[model samples]
Target chain A: MSVSALSRPSFSRRALLILLSVLLIALVVGMEQLAPLFRALFPDQDPAMYERESFLNLTLAHLALVLVSSLISVSVGVAAGLFVTRPAGREFEPLVSTLAAIGQTFPPAAVLAIVVPVAGFGFIPTLVALVLYGLLPVVQNTVAGLGTVPSQTLEAARGNGMSAWQILWRIELPLAMRVIIAGVRVSVIINIGTATIGSTVGAKTLGTPIIAGLVGNNLPYVIQGAILVGLLAIVTDLAFERLERRFSFGESGAMA
Target chain B: MSASHNPTRDTASARLVANRVLVTLLCAGLLAAWLLPFATMSPNRLASGQTVGLSEALSAWQAIALLALSAVLAVAALRRPLPRELAHGVVLLASLGLLLITLYSLGDYAQRTLVEKSPSARVSQGSAFWVMAFCCALAAIDAFQRASSGWLLRLGYMLIAGGSVAMLFASGHFDDLSIMREYANIRDNFSDQFITHLVLVGSALGPALLIGVPLGLLAHRHVRLQGTLFSVLNFFQTIPSIALFALLVAPLSALGNAFPLLGEWGIKGIGAAPAIIALVMYALLPVVRNTYAGLKGVPPATVEAARGMGMTARQVLWRVEIPLALPVMLSGLRIVTVQAIGLTVVAALIGAGGLGAFIFQGLGQYAIDLVLLGAIPTIVLAVIADFTLQMLVVLSKPAGTRR
Candidate 1:
């Protein structure tokens, strides 16, 4: 009975996840077909649909930016976190942690604005901003995750004649993988939201329509953009939830 | 023992033991100051500027003096025989000096180069100047962190640094700088928008706490309601702020149309109404989650003891549970407050007037200083909010719980 109770909910959640993903793609691809509906909703506006860029193309570009930036952030942030935790690099730990904490307090919009002057407005500048802003969560989590590894476990690994590298790879990393992935999840989610604002600076993302609509005072375009972006965020968040659950399950199964 | 006997070897080893963080930051600052443009001179606000190198920005002797001071600080950081406190003191003072000298030189250069040439001519901080400033701030912060564990002392040091800069500004030393010029142009609007930003944040926070805390208490009491409550709040949180604000426009406008009285009260498609509503929605999750977690985190034994002492559930909750949960709940408030402050800047995009108006306007006009005028204060406000709330969280800890 207990097994069935758990399994049934898992099945439904997977179904919901797939359902949302399908709905998101359908909305992106067929946004114009729903033009009449939008026109009805927003009766007076001409060009009720956002058509300067294809929603499909915009979605892809948005995802690509988030992926590239999150990739760079995770790699650099995780490495920095690891470096500062090791014995050779321990003295720098406080500085790195303090930086991570303080960096998060700077608003993403401000960071993007500052980057424009130095890097100018475009994909590269937006990517730079997203990576820098997304970094704090990953670094903080990496440090926190690695710190959770028990001293006894490290001692045992050392007693077995394992090299520091071997222990880190074998014992420490696996133990910390769940937390690190949680960080990545947060970074990716934030990057998705932030990437929308990138459209303000000239990077083609879903926010393009919203900014354009706001400027033009067209409600339909704003709605179209907002709906698609909202869908994407919800879909991504649900996917991460599944991923986190899988990792935790695997961790427990390994112990068993 | 043998190394101590050999003074030369001891000194060599001492040289190897450098304060890596300070040395690295100082060296980077030096290289950036030497290589990057120290300032820019623009003919007008709209036009891009000509880059001026450090030597051109300052007199020969002044440039050398600044470099000499930085080099001395780096050497002081490297020598192990120097006392740690002394090294930190030297680093703090020298970095502060570098910061002051850099700013003074920019103003001096601007006065000499632009004041007579064109009244509208602007002097902006160049890449090198920004990099140098950033490096100095970080190095000074590191020194402060190392020099004192006490918050009061660290705050005192910060005040000394910040006060000096404020004094310099007050003295009109930076009058020729572009950002200051922008401030002069929009002085009235800047203050008005600044107040609006604070008002927006406060309005949203007030409603969020009122709704969220009770919901949190309900969730804590009822095991079954917790999941649904959190999921709903989390769903709201997952939407991007821009998207959330935009999404509210249609429905809100419809409401305003359906009820003209609501429209009269400023409940419209785009403005503070939707902006505050969306902010409150975004804020609810943190407050609710934190409050629930705080309440649930109270020790079962303590709750039992309270009951055993003939205390009613209400008394136990009010007197014991609330006090114990205060710190964690305040931490949640900290996150909510800071997040709201940042989000308020984005609200300006929707016509919810705030510092973001300057930011967006600057972005529109390609005026970097105008952007700075907006972005800098938003960051400062967020940082100040974060620091103050962190102190609150620390202070709220019950006597035995203080760290």
Candidate 2:
């Protein structure tokens, strides 16, 4: 909302950060070249690390998994929430709430354990678990958002001859947009973190290095993998925060 | 679209409709249980199991009894002007009974089937049994919500139900099942892992509170610092638990090398040290956020009044701010304790020696029972921690203060 913040930074300044990050990532992916540096540090452990797949590929794969699962979770969670809030599906509110609560309370690791047998290993089971893990926030936010929509506003919409669907879309949803976005933010961020566990099931992600390091007692691999993952999480979170702020400000601007 | 919507009637009718749907779900879930396999019979633990449906495993009379009970619950759920308390009580009792009966009957069936068989044979409950258990839990929670009861009372009910099952379990009623067999095999190790899990959580909490409270107070005092502090903590939160664990190893190991005595004291890379460090890092956000929020929530007018009375800042903080903020702060502790309990299981992968050792071992062997031996207790621990901490938060609230 700050005018100074809205006045975007100069292109060169923005590009500097972007380029610096890119160069850093390049250095990491080509980290095998830095074996001497690693050897000087780790000394005892294997300095020449062999990550079969490139970090770029792993990062992309990890992000893709997060994206697909987050999308599914948001869609299903929001739809389920909307359905239960409707008169016909209202009875299902507690049932749906309980199901989501159980899904969340059950650790993602445990979910992986239970799901692996029926669904088999790799992406499907991991996706299933992540989606389930991600559902609670979206559903909770949707319910809270819809539940708090002022009755007077709904009545006004009805008085203006809007249909139920129209009121929900044009009035209720727009009003609840910020809350819904908050839910999606939470869900997606959670999926990003939880997705790291998918490496145990052999869905190659940034966790490959970390798991490999953990098993081999190779701290260098672990540090490299963890830094990338941690950075990704930070960058993604900041992006989401910026997106949320933009939406909030845009809505305020429209209102003004 | 009706303008003349009578809120009370609408809500009551909605409740009736919801009740009907829940009963339908219960009945359908029961039918699924009947149609699907109730347990699997494997020639050995490592062998692919054959499905044993309910009818194949249980007698016709047992099936009839279950069906009859299901019908009773369905009928009870549908009655007009539902007796909320009575219905809830019935639902609770019936669920507890059903779960016990199911477990006992399965144990009995396994014993009958395998008494003369090879020692390697394994009998495990199938997906149907799990689904039925889930449905029972769902229904009981729904009923519990409908019931107007205090936290202590609800907890007492849970204890009674849980304790009864534990008693039955201790009586060797479920020993024939593969899960219990696995538990029996590792009972001593199980206790040690449980203690280790508790210690990990307890140790993490001490440091978390020590650092988190001061950090929270600092952030609270300086508005500019709060944003950067929380963003850093939030960034820490978004890093996956395992990643955080992995990250801590290198630095911790270096520190250990620099200080021989610290290594002697178990401050190393691979074991509980890194695990506890990661947990403490993960815990700081909630504890800090909650502390800050709690302090921020104190009525400015009250603080003003205290200052007007010539109280020093520290005096106001200790005498006024703390008592007012204690409940919220405790709630934050509740969140972290529950979270830390669950996260500690992951710590076992690094030889931290918690329930996760069983879980990972089970995963390696593809033994679901062994996994359950660990996973179930972990869940139970988290739930108990959450419930107990929640009660503490409630109790700590000043008398007569509205929650």
* Best candidate according to lDDT: 1
Misplaced by over 4 Å in model 2 are: A1-36, A249-256, B3-18, B81-85, B308-312, B401-403
What tens-digit string does per-residue lDDT give for candidate 2 at A21-86? Answer: 675577557766777887787778765454677777888899899999999989998998898888
Candidate DockQ scores, in order: 0.49, 0.44
Local distance difference test values of all predictions, in order: 0.86, 0.79
| Residues B102-166, model 2: lDDT tens digits | 77678878888888888888899888888887777777777777775677778898899789878
Off-target runs (Cα >4 Å) in candidate 1 are A1-11, A249-256, B1-15, B60-65, B400-403
State which candidate has the highest DockQ. 1
Q: Which residue pairs in candidate 1 have backbone atoms (N, alpha carbon, C) closer than 3 angstroms, thus clashing? A: none
